[model samples]
Target: MVANQNSVVVVMIPLPLQGHLNQLLHLSRIISAHNVPVHFVCTTAHGRQVRLRLQGWNPNAVSTIFFHDLPIPPFACPPPNPNSTNKFPSHLQPLCEAATHLRDPVTSLLRKLSPTTKRLVIIHDSLMSTVVQDFISLPNAESYTFHSVSAFSTALYTSKKVGEQIRELIESKGVTEYDLSFDGCFTSDFKEFMSVQHEYAKLSSGRIYNTCRVIERPILELLETDARSRNKLLWALGPFNPLELKRKDDGPIQRCLNWLDKQASNSVIFVSFGTTTSFSLEQITEIAIGLEKSDQKFVWVVREADKGDVFNGNIIHVELPKGFEERVKDQGFVLREWAPQLDILVHPAVCGFMSHCGWNSCVESMSMGVPIAAWPMHSDQPNNAFLVTNILKIGILVKDWCRREEVVMSAAVENAVRTLMGTNEGEEMRERAVSLGQEIRKYVLGNGVTQTEVGSFIAHITR
Candidate 1:
């Protein structure tokens, strides 16, 4: 039998989707840079995507970073229902089943590695944690539960008491079965849930947030309390290697830097609904008018249509306002179908993000210290938007929610975009963002998995 001979730590990253993969790749690079031998555990299909995207260079100086593909059936999450946004389709019901099936693949892979002494870091999706039934049972290993979102996001996952009360009264169609909406979900009924979550956080050995100190001050405070009680590490590490990002430069990168050069520094408003989360045509019209009215120089990423049916009113995430692109072409005040997000966000000309609040985008934007115009689409997005608005105090929300759906009228968009674009408050918010960005950079490059902080973190788990 081939025994596991390598000594450097191995992190099994189960990256199911785009966001999940990016977060893991970022951390894997960080660890590999510090002399740790790292392997990104990708499914065969995903591994193919990685190879295509990454031109292939070593992640760090010494260690060789490679993709380890585990042959597993593609997970059966429901395709985004082309029919409507009003409800989640039944296709998604299989996610629970897929997550369950994944457990064995991960376990089998762990057992296949014969190095009994080597430590493991499973930098996978938070959703994958559901099937990670046992961690201590594995060979020398520690887990770090890294959220692609900010710490502020975790807090907002629970609605301020008021929203919960409203939900109780309203009794919406889907309200009965699910947990609380951003509107609210607080109850003594959650004792067991909280207990289990806290347990996992402790068992994790370390809890990492892809965020900065300024916006996440409160969430980290709460996390520290929880970690200290459980004696775990709480690391706020973010903006991890945007400029020097590599090991995957082969992907088609949007030439967004040239666009930024022509725009005024801190004057452009960047909008994107993430790789997923297409908007309805109605929603796009409203937003376009808003950008026009606000007189903001902006760039919004849209997606091409898939299937004949309208995913969201025939508009993909890449679609833009009709004729507006032509009108604002000179001012650079239009949108792109897709742009290199991190490259654009870090650019001096880019100022604020008008986002759907996907966890990855949220953290990346926050870490850049650019304020956000939160436009939550679904699931944890509303939760993320809440954090961007209330906890971070860096975001000025666009009053776009209507009957629980985004009602982004042009006027509303104008107000929110312009407010975030520039003003005394906006300037202060930008500075606060920059300050927070600095703190995040400090932790990421300061001492990642190699140092005493993360080393102690690994030690706690190995024992």
Candidate 2:
């Protein structure tokens, strides 16, 4: 299944974090299925993480997709501060800095692969553009910047008012020269990281979004009309995780799914913040009390946030309230590690999600027709919460962004859980969520928008 000498080849350079790596890996499978050879490049450690944790399709079976592992020098890996007043996960800043040192290895690999192909297409995460910038000058190498966030957040972030506010906030904290903004979520170093990315993105020949027109038409339209995006070849090819891939899980995962099978239809709520959100022990106690008081059937994933290196091999201890798990044993199930999120979302008994509104989780919840209790924690999360609660009308806000620094009281969590799972308003939101999911399905699964856009991208690369 290797490409012939004259065939177009694609190389993927994804940011080493979970969310970013997952999207580009999915895209690689899509492109490889069309007979294009794709080389997925990353550090040796992250490459192992990708292969071990990849859920649906088997990467080994995909002959056209190859793995290229590059080595970089060791850097410090710090754990995220669970109680930090600034909501951003600033501890991840060092990882981005470490990735920049890959420039030499990446450049060498690209040059070696360039001469054998008709075209060498480099599809890199928008934030990882610095790693590939030097090789874009090769005669046969063409690059596209792949944006992993939602279209709504991206558009809102680029607006004048939001941009200025973020700049002032960062500068007040001693940052001086970053161009992109995420409103108080990024630290000085993170701003510098983004500044580098923004500069290199201008060199890309096209832009790719992990979004579709159905759910984000207005936002996508806005981006298309924006001056920065004008005249660039834009493609919306997403809802990327295989919607219908049958997964086989055993042990704890199987038991979790079995528990879901026994619950009444639409009677359970799924509670989890993505990997990067951690709460103090006091906050965890409040969340426990809240869910218990709501008296709702639930499955909650409890784990500490990731360190700067996701594979740092050091585990931080995270504990629930003493005797609390025993008290709610009949009413709730608590999973202590990475739960199979998509499987639980698609289950019949799960009715709502209490989430951090991370973009990947938001997309998965929307695609599954599950309403959300939006508890935004940082980065694009507040904007995503607004999109879910205000724009999509498929969710309820659990925490106001203005009060994000305060611990959310148990009463507030209880009210939000009850409102999203037990009220008539919740039912109405469920209906709308289902309807939206159906419309999105038509585009991503049927022969509609996503198919056409993906086909166009392949045609562009091969033509």
Candidate 3:
């Protein structure tokens, strides 16, 4: 079934998020390396960001990856009345508008390519499933859905029993264990968004997950066995991360690297949530206090949040405990802007990660052999935290979604930090993490599982 490689094109449409874009970009790189052409569809704003980021990439290698910008549509939702309990609409409005507006332009792009292209395969974000129907309607165009979350998270969402279990967990107060039919493990406005994504998944030709077989075998196997999901082809083709890209040592990256050089091996905890996560002023103060109380060497990345943003509408000015900076001046560094996350994880000084447990961060930390202090924020992060702490045993939970509405006390944060960085159990977890990291590296290199799956996908699209 080997078709002419030069005649085929992969149309990659990622959701307008940093994590999703990063995974798809890396996947496109792998496909392009096989000499296959890639047409990456993104919004103008995201396209500009991508183009700027690629300035550091190998020009000749990425030459085949073309960008197609679908302008974000102007759509507005009425502001929440002062008394309305719903906050999800304001957070979701932008993405909803983007999804609805991008479909027509994406369809037009596919239509133009169909006449000359031998085969057109559209790989879209799972959330952007609305576009799949449009592409599949076009002549010679095939559509596949890609999830940026773990296989475990995917399985939980797709499985009826697991979904029910999660519902019960959400309803019951003080419920700690997520006892499911299998052993794996949101709001109404968030619920509606997920519902649309679930419906869209059913219409796709197949699905691709950014997780590996070895890491999530049980959940993946469950997905394979489920009657509802059994018919769809599931490809586990990841730790799809940009491991090879070297970070330029200038500004914050240089400062962080220099700071790391002074610390003892595996002594510092690297703290950061992914791009979209934001914290309340109370939460920030608590975290700062916790870190100070832990008395550990650390590097924490903090970002200012817009108060108007519905999802994470925290105050912009984060006031730490008075004299907090002076107290821990020798022991910590708080980065106000972006820090080189991947570079920091691989440093010898970083022993643990305080993370939101986003899939990208989770995979990156695991791949780098750095253990995590799981503090899940939203979306699939709660499930990811469960996987890291309970299933993978590579991390400990600092906070769970069940208590997301409540502010985490500094004592709780301090306890989690100490347990992750100082305790005997933490040592065991670190050892396991190092071993898993090595295994993941071997699995993604030449002729490994990830490569084989990517090859298989290329064959599927070409044939």
Task: Name the best candidate (by lDDT).
Answer: 2
> Against the true structure, whose TM-score is highest?
2
The whole-model lDDT of each prediction reads 0.59, 0.83, 0.74
Q: For candidate 1, what is the total of clashing residue pairs?
A: 11
Instruction: Put down candidate 3 lDDT per residue, 31-99, tens digits, no spaces.
Output: 887778899988776665555444125534578888887777644423332122221224434555465
Q: Model 2 misses residue 391 by how many Å? A: 0.7
Candidate 3's displacement at residue 181, Å, is: 12
* Residues 62-135, model 2: lDDT tens digits: 99999998887888877778888786777777777888887898899899889888888999998988889986
- After superposing candidate 3 on the true structure, give the runs of residues whose Cα lies further than 4 Å from its correct spot: 1-5, 50-61, 75-92, 161-176, 179-185, 227-230, 305-317
TM-scores of the candidates are 0.76, 0.92, 0.87
Residue 309 local lDDT, model 1: 18
lDDT of 1 at 367: 64
* lDDT, residue 5, model 1: 49
What is the TM-score ranking, best to worst?
A: 2, 3, 1
